[model samples]
Each structure stands twice: as C-alpha cells, then as structure tokens.
Target: MARWRAAAFAAFLFLLLAVHCRGGKTGICYGRNADDLPSPDKVARLVQQQSIKYVRIYDTNIDVIRAFANTSVELMVGVPNADLLAFSQYQSNVDTWLKNSVLPYYPATAITHITVGAEITESPVNVSALVVPAMRNVLAALKKAGLHKKITISSTHSLGILSRSFPPSAGAFNSSYAHFLKPMLEFLVENQAPFMVDLYPYYAYQNSPSNVSLNYALFSPQSQGVIDPNTGLVYTNMFDAQVDSIFFALMALNFKTLKIMITETGWPNKGAAKETGATPDNAQTYNTNLIRHVVNDSGTPAKPGEEIDVYIFSLFNENRKPGIESERNWGLFSPDQSAIYSLDWTGRGNVDIMTGGNITGSNGTWCVASTNVSETALQNALNWACGPGDVDCSAIQPSQPCYQPDTLISHASYAFNMYYQKKGATDVACSFGGAGVRTTKDPSYDACFYLDSEKIINTNSTPPPAPSASSPSLPGLCFTLLLPVLPIVIASGFL
Candidate 1:
C-alpha cells in the first residue's frame, strides 16, 4: 500500500510540474499620451481589478511606478529614444536614471524588464547607432546594482526590420540595418533577452486587403490556411505567420536561440472610412483570439509548443496620438475606465466582447473538489488553481478564516470555486482535470465563503456588457496554489 501510494504521488507531482513549466503570459500596454487618462493610482487599481498580471509602460513614470508598489503586477519600464543618446554617452547617466527611477521602487513594484528604447529602427531620425551602447550602459548599471539578473535589458523593434516575410522560412532582415542589427542580436543572445517586436496583423491587412483576407488576419475559423512553400508549413492565422517570419529572420542571421516577445499587438476599434477592416466586431475578434492564442501556449508553425509572452497595445485610447483614427483607437478601455469590450485575462472562456453583457446569470453555482476523486488528483488541481489559474488563495492560508478545516479538500474547494467564479462560473471552468464538480449547495463553512458568479462582476466605472456566445470555448488552463502544509497533510495520512 505504501509503495503504491508513493508511485501515485510521484505521478501526480510530475503532472503538476508539467503544468507549472508551461509558459506564455499575456500582458497589457499602459499608454498615457492622452490628457483624459485616469490618475496613476486609479489606473493601477483598474489593472489589479482586471487581474492583469503583466504590464508594459512606455517610460519610467515615477507616479506609475509607485502606483503598482506592493501589487502582484509585474512591470516592463522603458527608456525613451531621446534618452538613449544621453544614456549611451555615459554609464553614470544610466546609473543616475536607474537610481532615481528604478531603485526607489523595484521589488515592491515587481519591475521585470528595462526596455532601452521603443522601435528605434523605425524612428524618423537615425538614432539607431546608440541603441546597443545604451543597452550596454543599462546592463552595466544593473550589474552595479546587482539587479542584472533580476531585470532583463532589451529593446523593442518594428516588423519593418524584416525585408522578406513571405513563405516564413525565407524571411531575412534588411542588410541596411546590419551595422546595428548584428550587434543587437549578439547582445540579446549573450544576455539571454528576448527580441521584442511589435506585430500588427491589422496593418498587414490594411496595407494589402487584396492579398491578406480579413478572416485570416482575424484568426477566424473560416479562414483558409496559408502554406509556406519552402517548408510545407501551414499558417492558419497571420499572427503565427508574422511570428514565424521573425523566427526565420533570426535563424537566417544565425541567432536562432533567442526567444521572441510581442511587445505590442492589437486591432483598432474604430478608424477612418477607408480603413474598411477596422470595426468593433473585427477588433474584438482579433484581440480575443490573440489573447487565447498567446495564453494557450499555441506557438507559431516554426516553433511548435514554445511559449511566447505577449502584451496587447494601449490599455486606453490616446486622443492626442497623431495619425489616422485607427492609430488612436487601439485601447481595450476608454478614458473613463470603462471596458470597451470585456476580456477574460485568464484566457479560458469564449464569450464575445463586441455585443457584451454580464458573463452568466447563474449566481448560486459553486465549484468544489470531488469527494470521489483520488487525493492526488485533488492536490494536482489545487496547485494548478493557485498558480497559473490565478485564483486568490490567500484566504486559505494559516490564521486566515478558511484555515480551520486544514484538509486538502477544503483548500482545494476554496481555490476551485475562485477559479470557477473568475472564469464566468462556467461548467468548463469547474473541470479541474475531472477532480472538481459544480454544486448548487453552498460550500461555505463558517467564515469560509466560496465566491459566486455575481461577485465576479466587472469593477470598471461602467458595468461591462453581458457576454455573447459567439466565440468557441478554449481549453481551461489549470492554476497551482502553493500550499505550505501539503507535505504535512500527506505525512499525516489525510488522503
């Protein structure tokens, strides 16, 4: 009996580790170019309310940095193009910036990446030569502060760096950028940083509607797949094709090991009349599918199963942005902190954002761990529920209200219910790898209350629209909660 139990536990642990190892995180870009944007504190609250774990801002605004202090959200701060020259000129300049901007609020704010510049290659003025030197200076400053390992240093680029993107396998960078591109690629490889690129399928379709179909660009189910002639790889969506093109471009330059991160990508909700593809429906479809694609760990055709982190562009629309109407309309929310359309940051449900409404009317349903399932399965589900599933498991900790029961079942139930409720209280969210079940009965014991669907309402200034059943359901990503007493429970034969 002991040997069998040990084997079962080992298998369960393996499964839990597999779930934990899988990557791909979805984040949002918080742009504040407009005058009507919310205060930094309010914006931080809005981000937290939405359960957005990762955020990328254009600069190291002290107010924005301080706003996220003590929050779980990880920030990727930037150094503007204008500052690149000054930073590159002297290491002291970079150190001073880091001292004032970063050191004051670092671990408290969870700042992860320090992007040196944004799309430097596409800048109107040729400041391209200073990028690598600035990056080196930034790295030196980080090393001086012993933060080189903690905070990654890199730069963002536009897809314009690629001269040939068709056939994906034949993709290569423009030779004109070799002076900087070669050194930049080498620096990225040495430092183990990702090659950040801003990929917009909306622009691809807009520039050539005759060639790029709207369905293909939107990642629609009805779109016919485009086959790469050189490698016989089929690209069902333009996002993957564009990503694979970058991969191939890197491979052509012999820098295949470096990972890629999507620094910016989104469709506009509104645009000028000539921009036929820009509409609420199209934007909703594109972003919704893109989120699903990234969080699902669905890598491009070139690198199957490789996890890629992606950040959607512009959290709020900037009225001051100078360009066509579409250039100013990539925000997921309006200036008043209302969701333009609802998005499940967890990436599980397939509810429509365009004709939005409340997620589900059922407020009484609760998800709990099944009594019939093996304890090992319940433990696995519990770990997943707390980790990637993003369930707030603090209540179940010691001295907390829910800590009395102290059984695996109690903790797992609390986590499962939170996960279920967050995922719109859907039957699918309650699966928990078949270790969970939905029940109308209240699972709350004393002060240990399980979250219901009604409690999962949007916290925006304006209530979000009800979810429409237009999109297809995605497979649930199980989250893991780190229970400190799991070993004790097992040793005590609680199973």
Candidate 2:
C-alpha cells in the first residue's frame, strides 16, 4: 500500500511540474521605441497569428494595451525608469497610474505581471535606489484595488548584478549593488514573483572572442563543453552556464529556491563589419536551438528537469535605436511584420530547411500524416484542408481518380500534398500542426496525376498569387503571409 501511494504521488508531482512549466512558458518582448512600425492592432493580430501566448512590453501604451484586450496573450507591463521617482514617492500616484493605465483594461488585457523599472541596477545610484520604493507603492496600490493577488510585481535585471560568475559555484552579487538588491530579492520572495533577468550570450561571446568558444555560445552540437571544476557539471551551451551562474549567486545570498525568469535573450540578425558571428544563419541557429532547449525543458546541470521560463528580446527590429548595428537587429520580426527567420516555439519534430537560398523547398516534397500522429488530428486536418483550406478534395472523394481502398490516411495524403502545392511548397505550409509531415517520396497513384514539388516551385507553371482582401478571395484556400515567411497561426487554413 505504501509503495502504491508513493508511485501515485510521484506521477502527480510530474504532472504538477508540467503545469508549472506551462504557466512559465516561452514569451517574447514587444518593444515599440521605433518609428516605422505597424499599428498596435495589426501587431496584436500578428502575435496571435504566430500562436505566441505570453508577451512583455516596455510600457502600458494604451494603444498596445487596447490591442491585446480579450486575447489569450498574457501580458507583463512595465513602469519605466522615468516614472520611478513619482511612483515611489506617492501611493496616490501609483493608484492614479493603475486606474488610468491598468484597471480599465483588467480581465480583457490579461496583465499578469507589473515589471517596475527595467535593469535598475544598470541605472544611476539615485534611480536604482527608487526601484524598491516604487515597487512597494505599486504593490500597495495593487492591494488596494484587490489586484495584488492576481497580478505579480517584479523588476528586470542585467547579469552585471553578479560580480563573480565564472565557475558556476563561485557566482555572487556585486558588493556595490547589494544594498539595492537584497531588499528587492526579499520582496520578490515574499511576493512569490520570479527574479527577472536579461541574459545575452551573444554579447558575452562577442566581447571575449579570445576566451569564449563561438560554437558553445551558439549552442552548437559539436562544441566541446565547459566542465565547472567545483560542481563537475558540463555546460555545452553558454545559455545554461550563464543561467546557473545567477542560480548560484542567489543560493550564496541564502535565497536558495527563488524562481528566475529570463526576461531578454536573443541574437542580433545583423551587425557591423567586425561582428563576425552576427549573420542571418547564425541568428537562426541560435534562436532555433534556444527554442529547442526551452521546449525540451532541458534545465541547467545544477537543476535538471527544472522549468526556466524565457522571453526572447524584441519582437520587431528597431531602426531608430542608437547603438551598434547589432543592437538594431535583435528582432525576430522585421519592421514590416515579416519574420526574420522561421522558428517553432515548441521545437517538436524536424525543422524544414530551405536549400540554395530558395524557399521553394528541397528537390522533392510529399505530404503525409506524421508518425505517431493521432487519427483525430489527421481527421481534423483533412476536414480543414478539404473544407475551409479549399484543397481539391474531389480527387479523394468516392470513386474518384485518387480514391482507392478508401482509408483516412489515403484521403489525408492527397489533400495535404495538394494544399502544400498551393502554398508555393514552402516548408511551413506542409506542417498541419504536428499531424502532417513532408516527404520526398511521391504518393501518387495511377490515373491520379499529382503535381511534383518542383512543378509548384516553377514560376512559369505555378498557381497565381493569392488575391487581396478587396479582390475575389479563393474559397477555403489558405495563403502564406506575404512578407518574409513567418510562424504558423492557430486556426490556420492548412490545419
């Protein structure tokens, strides 16, 4: 009886851990300090279309806040450093600010957290000193409104807060900033909010080329890993090493179990002439691997199987920023709402890579149900592809040319490939969530002439471009977003 009880408890614990990770799932930063950007509503649409669930914005811009109303996107708003003094000095100021900035958009906005000041330790001593007081006032105001329980309160930090971080075990906070941080840490513990910190392995590698291995910083599979002498833990990627450094630093400060949130971590897509590793390919690799790491829930060596919630920095590239070229290029999307590169949030299954600089897909392509995919998923995908997706389902209908033996798998294969062909044969088009997979083998049968991948890719014989909203719309046919190919949206035509 005792053994059975322990087994049941262990199973329950595993499920609980999964739920926690889901709550702390990956999110993106929506910074709008640029001029040539899309309207907040369109941006909100783009975010949802990409299936991103959580977001962190620099401030509670009314336009952006209004945009996210009633959406599934969980938001974390900020109290900029400029407002710190006023917010800290008066509770009334905080109250008025919340009433004006937050309350009106309560349940609709889904504002889960309030980040009071970003990277305060990086600010001047006067400003840094006000962060805690400002946070306290904000907390008080939230309590008064009965929102304290629902909305968490915390601030972001730079890794510079830690003075010693080389060996994972030796990490410690900088003595100069301890006075500002100790209370902040105490408040976070008391409130049960995560300690948000900005971590950039790109800058770490860029700054110290002589010492940092480029492959390790890029999270390459072939990179020889670093083994911490004290902990004897091997760190192949710079991301894990950097995270564990803060973990140890917190442990040394006696806050052993505080949760850490990676508020900002991303690679720049472009940079100056001297920026060796700041190319599009490297950025793709870094971010793709980053997603895979987080999705797999592969925690640091010090905390294996633990959850590490992350928010990639900057949704759209900023053009007006005053910094190196790389600073302006840490965006997943361009200013035009185009994706910088394709990235899967869950990183499940294999990514479809374009070859020879052509997104027409590789030499050959076929679409079929993915291995181990559920029948229910395949049936839904089949319905979407044939019905709203507007594929030529007549080929698979009864007594038709493609229909034979009449299996769900057979009907799905025909529809999936047809839909893939219609969408210009882009790799992402073939992904019907996880139910569909692209293959090189032709699944065509006698009298059922299916188009090859190359036929769709050819400009001369390809289908006409998708019509605009004002133009005659194709019934049930899903089209890709017109710009640099982006992520898959929920309720996609392909699905």
Candidate 3:
C-alpha cells in the first residue's frame, strides 16, 4: 500500500509539472540594468511565482540561465551588438559563443531562441550588415552542438524599419534598406523563424499629439479613427496600425508568409514634460489594455483571428538605463520584484502600478510594490475586472464615479477595446467612433455617437433631380428646403 501511494504521488507531481510547463509561449524581456534588483536565483523565483513561463535576456548572462535550470521557463538569449562584428567575420567566433554562452545552460535552462543582435538598425555600428552572416554562423554552431532544432536564431528590429507606416496598408520598407532586408526575409522564411519588432504606439502619440488621438494611442475608448484608403479598414489603435504597417511592408517585399512577433511593447510610468503621453494613467491604461488583448491571442487588422504573440517590453525598471528618463521607467515591476503596475491577465485588480494607489516605493524612493493588499484581495480585483463574462471595469462602473477606480477602469477599457477591435474583429469604426466622436464609456459600445444631422439619412452618391414649378410636389419641396436648412439647424444646436 505504501509503495502504491508513493507511485501515485510521483505521477501526480509529473502531471502538475507538465501543466506548468505548458503555460504557452509568452515571454518577458529580462533586462538587467539595475544594481539593486533581486539576485538571478531570486529573480527566477519571482518569475515562476508570477507564472511568467518565458524570458528574453539582453545577453548571455550565465547566472540567469543557471538559476532557471531544471525549471520550465524558456529563455531567448541575445548576442550583444558589440560582439556581432567579430561573429560575422569568423564562423569560429559564433561556435565559441554557442559553447561558452549557450550550450552550458542547455536542457536545464531551456534556452529556446538566440537573437544574433539587438536593434541593429538603430545601432551606431554597421551592425545591420553583420546580422545575416552572424545569424548563419550561429545556426551552424547550434547544429555542431546538436541543438539546432531546439533553439531558434533570429534578430529583433524597431518600427523604424518602415519608411511609410501611417495607414498600415500603405506600409513600405525604406528603399535604402531593401538590399539587406530582402535576403534577411528569405533567410527567416527558410529557417521557419519569426521576424521580431519592438513596437510602441506611445512614441507615435508623443511625437504628434495634434494628429494622434490619446485614446487611440493609449488604447483609450475614444477617437473617430482614420480609415485606410487601400483596405477601407479603419484603425482604432496606433499599435495595430504599427503592426499592420510591418505586415504591409513584408507583403510588399513578396514575403507575405513570414510571421511577425512583437518582442517588446510597453509604456513608461514616468517621462519628461516634453513627453506628453507618458503618465502613469496612460501607462496603466496602455499595458492593462495591451495585456487583455494579448491574452485573447489578438492579431492585427490585416491578419484577423491569427494568434499574434508578443512580449511586454520589460519586467522591472532599471535606474541605470541610460538615455531619456522614460528608458529607465518602462518596467512593469519595480526593481524589488514587486509589480509596478497591476495587469488584468489574471482577471482581477490588486494595486495597479500605473495608478500608484496599490503600487508603493519599496526597492527605492522611485520604485513601488503591491505589498499592502492580500493575495485574495488581489485575485478578487483581477476577477472583477479581467475574468471573461465579468463586467468590464470600464463598461460597468459605479453609478457615482469613484475617481481612482473610474479613471483606471476607463483607461483599461480604452486600451482593451482599441486593441481588440483593431486586431480581433473586422469592424474598425465600431471599435472607435466612426468620426469626431469621443468618449470612454464601455467595452462593447463607443462612448460618443456620430451626430451629423446635416448629412443625408441615407448615403446617396448622386444628386436628386431638379423640381420644376408644375411638377413641384410636396415631398420634393419639403426635401429641397430641408436639405438647405439642415446645415443651419446643426450649427444652431437645434438638430
């Protein structure tokens, strides 16, 4: 009896472990720029605790991989920009990179993908040219280690690759980059690897607040939205526009079969005065909304019902990150492994980092955590806001507004509706107000309604026939006078 019980216990444990490993392919960018973050092992615990099954590290950090050993988390490691030039010239360099940086952590850490270079287009060096050769060498090295099929090799890109990307359908790659891009696409298609891009709609809005709608960019519940002339497809959110822009660019390149994965996409919790859309409210709005869309396996307008995979930009903010303040502030968590923002992936609210109500300063003066609330409370909050069939926080608000809760819900709804409407469904205008309507009211309905009384009741492409004195009928007379006076009525607010 004792032996049978032990065997049964072991079998149950194996099943539980298998279920944990099958959590899907969602990954997080585990950037290490801060000095005070929890150690790699502790960080591993945090990741597992949060149910984050995959991670992408910027470099071949041995400690990180080793810590993840024997666990289910999959890792996609990077070969830094500085090392690419060397790997490009000599195949041996890539072989060594594999042996020293990769194979050592194999089987244990589950290193699934290796990025040859990071954001080569934006790199200062002639790194773009080196990417292809380095990728080829890395593949060869992987084969040498008998780990070829186990790991994927590719490079990540920024949205800057698109020379034209406004309407998305009209997207095109820069003429200057076609030489390299053409071959790169061929390689990716042959290898069965995805083309990764770091997309952020927040930057677009920041650069052009006058043209980009805050709701559209931040995934708000507002905006009349713009229609793509070529596709007659309306874009409710800027993120979808950015993604489809890449799709259009690829299609134009004659590589329509290639898969595009978003490797990084998130908003900053802090920013300079000039950076208009970087507020916590907007960040919470963008990320929370983004999470809802991602969990649903949402795709871009051009590829509806497709399961588009994306990795949120980062797990924690790094004070050490150089450049604009926003660079150091894009983390979903504070340095101490506490969530900087609350996400609805688990289907409830705790303390959302974007709101700063549940998040607090724990890692340092600048960091925050959701330590005050109990796990049950956090889970309940998530269920209330995130669970399927649950009342959408934005749609079913209190009859009387609770300033904090209402605003958070409004922002969350905007982000969720914008992303889903654009990516999941065929109706774009339905997600966004058709034109000039603006309101953040619900998940399924536009807050603002189109109210143009001057417009004809029905869409008529041709003008009506002229009425003669003898043939002046009551219906024609009334219609002619009504048409002329409609503009005045609308202007006078009497319609």
lDDT (10s digit) by residue, model 2, range 1-495: 655544554454344445543523788999887899999999999999989998999898998999999897999999999999999899999999999999998989999999999987777645888999999999999999998999999999999888988887788999998777999999999999999999999998999988898877877643556767785666667888889999999999899889999999988889999998887777877776677567655567677546688998879999888789998888889989998886777554333323213233434767776544557667877887786465768877788898885888878888888876765554434545345666778777788766765665463455577865333333222223121121231123221
Count clashes in each candidate, considering only residues at least 3 apart in sequence or on different chains: 15, 3, 17
| Model 2 segments more than 4 A misplaced | 1-24, 350-495
Q: Which runs of model 1 end up more than 4 angstroms from their true locations?
A: 1-21, 351-495
RMSD of each: 13.9, 14.5, 20.1
TM-scores of all models?
0.71, 0.69, 0.68
lDDT of 3: 0.65
Error of 3 at 232 (Å): 0.6
- Choose 2 or 3, whichever is better by lDDT: 2
For the record, the alpha-carbon RMSD of candidate 3 to the native fold, in angstroms, is: 20.1
CA lDDT, every model vs. true structure: 0.81, 0.77, 0.65
lDDT of 3 by residue, 1-495 (tens): 655544554454354445422322456788889987889999889888888777889888888889999879988889999988899899988887778877777888898888888888888776788888888888888888888788888899999888898779889988977767877888899899999899988888888889888878865444445667776665667888898999999998788898888889988888987886787677877776666455543345566435567788788888898988798888878887777766655412223323435421111111111233234322333342234312233433455332233443333433333332322221221232222122323223344211121122233337567755323223331232233334654475432
- TM-score quality measure for candidate 1: 0.71
Q: What RMSD does model 2 have?
A: 14.5
Which candidate achieves the best TM-score against the true structure? 1
